[model samples]
Target: MNPILDAFWYILPAYFANSSPVVLGGGTPIDMGKKWRDGRRIFGDGKTWRGFFGGLAVGTSIGVVQHLILPSYYGSLRIAVEVAFLLSLGTLIGDLIGSFIKRRLNLPRGYPAVGLDQWGFLISALCFAYPVRTIPTGEVLFLLVVTPIIHWLANVFAYKMKWKSVPW
Candidate 1:
């Protein structure tokens, strides 16, 4: 593949990882109402199993597609699967960790986390997959910094559309 195409292939997962559960995942927290009890689910009403699984599926699919379409960029099929699993798992774990911290701090669900939820996915994915796969530290930092802002923007849009109860 060409240099631009190679770059696109390399960045695919980063962009994919930046995708929000609020935007792609088909559940809404506003519909659950403001009452904390009604809003309190695993990671609040907005964070559903469907969203989690959907993210996993998306991550895995992206890895698989990259392996098929740009094997030269990503190496072996096994590596692709590992990367996908780690990325998706990392994203969900990060969001969950953020929720735990929020609860400990007495922050209510749908309360803006500033950038926690946004960055959580990437951090968790990296940490979780660290043992299995090695990624460059600079690249990791780039993902950490970029993913949250991307997430925040996505949330802003989701909030405007009433797809999410809060924008953080």
Candidate 2:
């Protein structure tokens, strides 16, 4: 099996986990409309419990399907599910963290933050994936380089489709 292909396969959960929230967002903000000490919304309206859990479910479900249908490639059910959960969870956490940091910097919701927006979730997802699944060095490098472009392109597509407020 090609290691780069495996890396791409491994990060799918994180990819979906990061993107699903945009489509599945709204409702009560995770911060519940509270203001932080700095007079900023904790996570803003964009970060909602619905989007968070929904993204996790969507990403993990994709991983489960991949594991079930392609066991040889994805590995055992337990490991796949576990890693999927970790990756999904990590992805969401990373997004939340990014939002928090951006809020601290007074960046409004949907505003682009360059590297933080592009690589944060992927980095967090990789952190979770490292313990349970071994990603080849080449594949990790591949993901690091390709994911940002994919992220940017996806955002552009979403912006064109009116699903997102910004092109970034």
Candidate 1 colliding pairs: 90-125
Local distance difference test scores for all models:
0.65, 0.88
8-37 per-residue lDDT for model 1 (tens digits): 344455356545465666565422433345
Tell me the deviation in Å of residue 146 in model 2: 0.9
Candidate 1 TM-score, true structure as reference: 0.72
Best TM-score among the predictions, by candidate number: 2
> Which run of 10 residues does model 1 get worst, by summed lDDT?
29-38
